[model samples]
Target chain A: MNDSAGKIKLPTTILMIVAGVFMILPFLWMISTSFQSPSEVFSKWLPSKLDWSSHERIWTGSYNFVPYYLNSVKISVISTIGAVFLSALAAYGFARIEFKGRDAMFLVYLSMMMIPPQVIFVPKFIMFNWMHIYNTHWALILPGMFSIFGVFMLRQFFMSVPKEITESAFLDGAGHFKIFFRLVLPLAKPALATFAIIDFSWHWNDYENALVFLTSPELYTIPLGLQNFILENNVDYNGMMAASSAAIIPMILIFLIGQKYIIQGISSSAVKG
Target chain B: MKRRSWIQKQGWIGYAFIMPNMLGILLFFIIPALFSFGLMFTDYQFANPNVSFTGLDNIERLFQDEQFYSAVRHTGIFLLSVPISLVIAFIVALVLNRSVYLKGLLRGMFFLPYISSGVAVAFVWMLLFQPSHGPINEVLRWIGIATPPGWFADSDTAMYAIDVVQIWFMLGYNMIIYLAALQEISAEQLEAARIDGASARTVTWKIVWPLVSPTTFLLLITGLIMTMKSFSLIQAITQGGPSGSTTILSLFVYKTAFSYYEMGYASAISWFLFAVILIITIIQWIGQKRWVHY
Candidate 1:
């Protein structure tokens, strides 16, 4: 039995190590190719020198990444903050407070999650044009702030907070606004953090929406900037790779910092689903 | 009586709290959704006020359109990656469920792709599959194959290349979900199966596999839905080209509306996409009873 167990370990380790390498090979390649010269990219496995030209070109050129990077951070951060606050407020109402037809209304809101965002691009285009927000960051940020999933997830979290806590707070003659800001929101910090992190990453990584809405080169987010880089310098693999590398730095930073909640959030979503 | 009055007062505040989101949803999502249904029947060019009610013309064009048919076919190929990723993720989950070295690190590495920017992911793979001297083809030639597929450069092979990226992209997410389900399985159940003189294969098939079928079911339905709607990676990599061979349904909708300014035609294509999603959802609602072991 011991001998058999030892034998199985070798193949499993080899298999896992190989899979692990495949998982990260693209990221490694992104960094490696970014630093390699055009001539040496396909020829060399790793760059011979730590090249800074590609990285330098992005900042100093006519098309700078400064606006793109700032746009991404600005859009995602604002969207995340608004999403957390508004979702928590509404989810608090649904989870705790009672009103006429509340359950029925909540059911309607929940069903909207089933509607894929692709189905709306046409009318949204018309609507945004009419509203005069087309081709602006507002087009992305406004709709982005309202995540149905965030409301649902935070509702679940809020529901698990004992009702007695809310009841006792109510007895102190405090209004719903005060109780929410003073009691529920503070208690649901972990849930809020989880949603904020997830939402931030999503808006940060959002491409199709940003692609459709933002046409001006200056208003573009990081993903849009990277796509612009690709289109402008189609075969400039070194420059494209450098831009792509720069694009994911914030995401990697977020992942490293909040991976615990990110993983937990994913797991809980599966279990809950 | 006083307490009852206070409860009634709180109800109005509930509405106040919920009003902003409710109105936003109604305006942004519900209105647009209903508006698209209306647009499906119109000859509305985007940003052009000259609109005509060409009832059913767009829908008629959709059925007769050759590009629509190919988008459907590409969507079928794209969805295939979901199941393929699920199987591989399940196997990996089972392996890592046991006492594996660097399990946490491996889990994080795999999940990174799922969370990474789609454009970045697409660009890296484009370089790797750079047909002539790109590393993937180079390695294929090195391994004794005289000719290799022209991945993104060839119309015939582009969809399959996208599948490889989709599979890689979804593997970590599927694995993480599977790992969660696997952790829920009790060890005593596996021990009991082994004690009954069952081989490792028997234990896995009869015990572990059955236990995670619900996760499998959940991932399948959601993954299929999510993968069909995925656009960015394909948009960045090929933009439905080397001749539009990789144009899945969502990309087709994007092109018809934004690229061609054919809002009416795009609405028709997207409505078809929604109908397909509805059918899959209905199937999951019904099919869960038959095979999704709780």
Candidate 2:
């Protein structure tokens, strides 16, 4: 932790700040442009006056973003909860229970991470269409509720839970379900929270899946709805930026609140894999 | 009898625990993947309900598809982003690890783009790269450059333009990974190197780089796979436009399957994609043995 290497600290600090500016400038520009009037949007770097028309239009005008926001919240929340709960169950099984074919089952689950979803996108579309859920929120939410990555991550955390803890519970005649719910799940909250944040953000930003699956505008998530809004209002940068800022605010807030978990989740996955 | 019953009870517990997820994956993922493989050999258009089996016809057509090759080329070009992002991320992580002031603030700023939606990222960059009125060109003009390449609009630079955005998007994720690994390097070793009067460059190269190779390998593989399958940026930003210069394989697959409704052809294309991803993943597994130092 003693990182006071003074010789090159100033240069490194300055360099990182410059690079940080490169990273954050676009986001700052996004928020700035959203507040600019149409005439003032491209004329200057900063808005002359904070025009609320773009935000107002997106909320009240014909291009209402309320449905998109609500739908994104619905899908992300439902899928995040479902994925975490189900994956926790499976992780407990894989980590604690002496089940037949458990290792093989886990290997298959891990392999799911490598197979890019593009390969299955068409067929999943067909399947969802056949199931009469193609245009519904079910199309967006159902397929995402089972994340192999979540299972893989949580299983690692679960396995790290001391054997004696589980063994002692087992000796007390606590069944797998009882142990999972009463002990392991509580202990794995950090890992669960990490995966939850990840899953939520992934589902929130999922435009491609929504684009492929959902056809009804009413059921569209924010990403797909935003895309439609952009195409309809491509020349209206002010309005587009406003709508985009609205769509991105929730995820940004989530990241701000739980970014440590996000970074921890990612690095742990990397190191373990 | 007791042992057998206990074994049976344990099996039931395990099944109960795993059933919800397994059922979902089986119905949603495994079934669709298998059905897609079956569709690859058939001529299954969305309009025509009667699907006719056409063995190898789709594969034959895929070989002759010019857009497919164009997409493959664009994907290969985009793959350059993995190494580019890895190096940039590692350097940033290294520097950020050294300086402690406002570390969290700087890291959060760098990571904002990655957490933002693709639509937001694509739109913001598109506005920034707007040739006439955008700020990038304004800066370029002030610096005495009369014309900047019409980013995302000009065919010659469209792919590179997309690559730059992809790199920027990936840098934060990769940098976080590298930073975690770099910080884990023992303080004692760094102190030892300093006491021995080793230069910063040597310390980085000899100690820091080797220690972080495993993370670098992990980031490189994940980055490559993510970039290979990435299409949202193209969809939102360029729509693989400017004469298909930015058309990656995922976009092509999406277009073929949905836009054209050529499910069979799309399935074949996807199979090809699956094969490529499998090969790359295999290479990662094998190559990690050589370069990844645990």
Most accurate candidate by lDDT? 1
lDDT (C-alpha, whole model) for all candidates: 0.88, 0.86
> For candidate 2, lDDT tens digit of each residue in B1-294?
644544565767898899899999998888888899999999999978799999999999999999999989999988998899899998888878876478888998888888885777788899998888889889999899998889888988888888888888988888888887886888998889988998879989998898888888778777788888879888988888988888889899998999899999999998898888888889888988986776
Query: Would you list the clashing residue pairs of candidate 2?
Result: none
* Tens-place lDDT digits, model 1, residues B161-210: 99999999899999989999988988888888777889989988888898
The digit string of per-residue lDDT tens for model 2 on A1-273 reads 345577557777787888899888888898899999998887887898899999999999999999888998999999999999999998888887778888888787767776777889988888887899888889878888998888889988998899889877776788888889899888888899999998898998887898888888989888888889878888899999898888778789999999888888888887775
True contacts kept of each: 0.68, 0.71
Kindly give the number of clashing pairs for every candidate: 0, 0
The parts of candidate 1 lying over 4 Å away from their true place are A1-11, B1-9
Candidate 2: CAPRI quality band: medium
DockQ comparisons of all candidates to the true complex: 0.67, 0.70
Candidate 1 chain B lowest-lDDT run of ten:
B2-11
Best by DockQ: 2
